[model samples]
Target: MPRFYIAQPLAIGQLVSLPEAVAHHIQVLRLAQGELVTLFNGEGGEYGATLSDIGKRHVSVEIKTHQPREVELPFGITLAQALPEASKMDWIIEKAIELGVSGVQPLAAQRCVVRLSAERAEKKMAHWQGIIASASEQSGRNRLAQLAPLQDYKQWITQQDMHRRIILTPRAEQSLADWARHQSPQAVTLVIGPEGGLSDAEENLAIQHGALPLAMGPRILRTETAGLSAVAVLSGLWGGM
Candidate 1:
């Protein structure tokens, strides 16, 4: 069945028009009236609906039954990722959504290559949000992951208050396994640095903010790979995967 993300509350037997972008997709895919489709309200639930009409500029659907199912992780995982190159950031957001991250924070660290002004950050966040939406549709996720506004390293660290916070570092003596042994946190925040990784001062600041330095392995991973690896490990440990 075709799946779509809607911005409004969905109730059974209610008639609703698809968003403009989704309308175009329905038309191009030739989804006819009376065809069944799945719709999510980005509120962690899905609805079963039938295409009721295809208008000139919109497509309408009649919601039949709501599937009260949510594919959320047991423990929330937020990725505080240092801004990478343009294309790599896009890839990271898409995969992060697929892996069931609750939220993504684009951070500007000492070694970050990409810089975003306030206006540019808004635009980039919007672009990354679209990537997340498409990834949710592809990955069978009903709720859309949140994309936090851009923040510099210091600001990002100051704002986080997660139960467990881990910064990915290759030289850290503590492995993730050691950190997870005694602590059972409701929410976990994982920070991954950019291409050049986190500077010493930045790492120390994160530690000051209650973030434990964790080594993924002996080898160094790219900025894009580090978050996904941590997410996968954490999700499995928390019984989400």
Candidate 2:
């Protein structure tokens, strides 16, 4: 069944008019009336529905049943990622959702190649949100991952956090896998730097603010690869995957 993220209230026994974007998708897919589909409102669970109407530019569905199924990580893992060059941030955010991250924080770190102005930042944020929804639909996740606004590295690192913050760096003696091996599942914020990695001063400041620095491995991984790899490693050892 085709799964869609409806950004509106959804309940059983109610007819819902699909949004324009989702309607267009259904038209493109050439779906017919009476076809069963899946819909989730990001509230918690998914609902089963059947296409009741398909107009030229609109569509509606009749909700039939609700499924309290969820595929979220046992521990809340937030990916605090530094902006990278080109469209890598888009790819990173999409994969992060697929990996079951609870949240994503985009940071403007020192040595970051790409910088977003105020106007562009607003547009990029909206674009990233769509990616999150699409990824969730494909990944079978009922809940949408939280997307934090673009923030500066210096300010974000110093803010008080409810969860442990772990920064990935080569300077660390113990690897992430080694550290996670002895630890149990818990909420953590994984901080990943940009192309050249976080500046020494920034790393020191993070350490002073209670961020744990851990190496990914002996080999150096790019900014896009580090966070996803860390999540995979954690899921492997922590039993989330």
Best by lDDT: 2
- For model 2, the local distance difference test gives 0.96
Local accuracy of candidate 1 as per-residue lDDT tens digits, 58-150? 899999998878887877888989999869999999999999998998899999888888899898988998998899988899988888888
Over the stretch 85-183, how does candidate 2's per-residue lDDT look in tens digits? 999999999999999999999999999989999999999999999999999999999999999999999999999998999999999999999999999
| Alpha-carbon local distance difference test for all models | 0.88, 0.96
Best by TM-score: 2
TM-score of every candidate: 0.95, 0.99
Scanning candidate 2 in windows of ten residues, the lowest lDDT window is 216-225
Q: Which pairs of residues collide in model 1?
A: none
